[model samples]
Target: MIFYNGDLWGPMREETNSWFSRIYSARYAACTAEEGHRNLVLTMAMDLSSKTGKELELPIDVNDLMKGL
Candidate 1:
């Protein structure tokens, strides 16, 4: 089964609370993202980072993207 390590951390902008575009992955794939581009992986990371005590969103549909893989 596919899963993600939810310990989301990032390099803070030199003392700022905001995270840079890189989210740490325990699986060591070293994922990266362009600024403001909400790719599926990043969306999952941000959802895991949330602490607002709300229900999570549904999983992203990567079927089409995965077809070529």
Candidate 2:
């Protein structure tokens, strides 16, 4: 996921935390691409906090995806 701006930090954190909580019991993977400045840090934090979640780095360009869309 790509966050264009950091203004949504509060909401983003809450959402990610909620997601992590739900999947805490099961094995899951959080795959994120380097689309924005804050995405890496946020996803990394989530990955580290989750007991069963693994973080995957996707080599995708959000800008290119957006252009295709």
Candidate 3:
């Protein structure tokens, strides 16, 4: 996705494969594009924390998605 004034922003990965199925498991099932998008954002946050060791908290629920809009 292109950059803009969006609430949930992160590096978007094409989910043509089961990238998160290992860690996220069943939660990755039946996910709307929106939910999968949210999972990717959280995954990015977690990855950043792992790389930087800066401990980041990411929400995985749609309730936190685009509430600003």
Candidate 4:
């Protein structure tokens, strides 16, 4: 299922968090922002791990992965 990992923290940051961008499957894909620029997979993992108290191994879509930039 689509899950939110966590947000990114920094001294000089524009945004507070990012989403799990790349996922292994559609169902497992993350629910990202509308603009799509703020969503970051790494940050998501960190967030989910901290908040939910569980480790997240994101599943990335193979087809989408190939098409990703």
* Candidate 2 off by > 4 Å: 1-9, 26-65
lDDT of 3 at 32: 72
Ranking by TM-score: 3, 4, 2, 1
Runs in model 1 with CA error above 4 Å?
A: 1-38, 51-69
Number of the predicted model whose lDDT against the real structure is largest = 3
Better of 2 and 4 by lDDT: 2
Over the stretch 1-69, how does candidate 1's per-residue lDDT look in tens digits? 222484434543332322332323334223345433346555554545464445444443445323423
Model 4: per-residue Cα lDDT over 1-69, one tens digit each: 223465444542332222223332334324446334334545545655677676655654334333432
Candidate 2, residues 1-69, lDDT tens digits: the string is 345565435446776866677589665445433344457555545544464464434543545333433
State every prediction's TM-score relative to the real structure.
0.20, 0.26, 0.41, 0.29
Order the candidates by lDDT, highest first.
3, 2, 4, 1
Q: Rate the local accuracy (lDDT) of all candidates.
A: 0.41, 0.52, 0.54, 0.44
Error of 4 at 25 (Å): 38
Model 3, clash count?
Answer: 0
Question: Per-residue alpha-carbon lDDT of model 3 for 1-69, expressed as tens digits?
Answer: 544664323454344335555436655356677877877777766665666777544563434333321
Better of 1 and 2 by lDDT: 2
